[model samples]
Target: MAATGSVALALYYYYVRGETQRGQFVGLWPATILGLAVSLNLEQMKRMLQDFQN
Candidate 1:
């Protein structure tokens, strides 16, 4: 979702600003989560499209 992506982006920005190892780790979490979410969503979407075609 857009909201999920936005949250991840915000976290990434925050870490960049803080410039610390901990911030870097926390920031990476959101990005990884967002990537997984998007990938899952895409798979679901593909299923929906295939169903519509049949």
Candidate 2:
């Protein structure tokens, strides 16, 4: 959801506001957030598996 919002905002900035540099900067945000989410989820799943084994 957050990633989608970031993309939308980036598009607005690029097309409507005419800020290419800023738009490109904002565009990177979604990938960063998604990477972080994946890492966190993997860590959480590992912990859950360990707990189940105990």
Candidate 3:
């Protein structure tokens, strides 16, 4: 959901508002957010497995 919003904002800046530089910069946010989400999920799973073992 948050990633979708970020992409919409990026498109708005790029096409609607015609701010190329800003759009390009904002466009990178979704990937960053998703990457963090994946990393956090992995960490959470690791912790869950450790707890299960003990």
Candidate 4:
């Protein structure tokens, strides 16, 4: 959810004004990095949870 929100925000910034809350870094680059991180974390956490379940 966080990853998706970040990506969606980035896209909106890029297409809408090419800027974001924290400037270009926030607008796209960092957002992308954070999105990737969040997504990977979610995936990893999901796997860990599944492992625990099993």
TM-score of each: 0.60, 0.94, 0.94, 0.51
Predicted candidate 1 versus true structure: per-residue lDDT over 1-54, tens digit per residue? 654665566666566566465555555666677788899999999999999999
**Tens digits of per-residue lDDT for model 2, 1-54:** 999999999999999999999999999999999999999999999999999999
Whole-model lDDT, model 1: 0.70
Count of backbone collisions within predicted model 2: 0
Encode model 3's per-residue lDDT on 1-54: one tens digit a residue.
Answer: 888999999999999999999999999999999999999999999999999999
Off by over 4 Å in 4: 1-27
Query: lDDT ranking from best to worst?
Result: 2, 3, 1, 4
RMSD of 4: 5.7
**TM-score of model 4 vs. true structure:** 0.51
**2 or 3, which is superior by lDDT?**
2
What order do candidates take by TM-score, descending?
A: 2, 3, 1, 4
What lDDT would each prediction earn against the true structure? 0.70, 0.99, 0.97, 0.70
Which segments of candidate 2 are over 4 A away from where they belong? Answer: none
RMSD to native, candidate 2: 0.6
Per-candidate clash tally: 0, 0, 0, 0
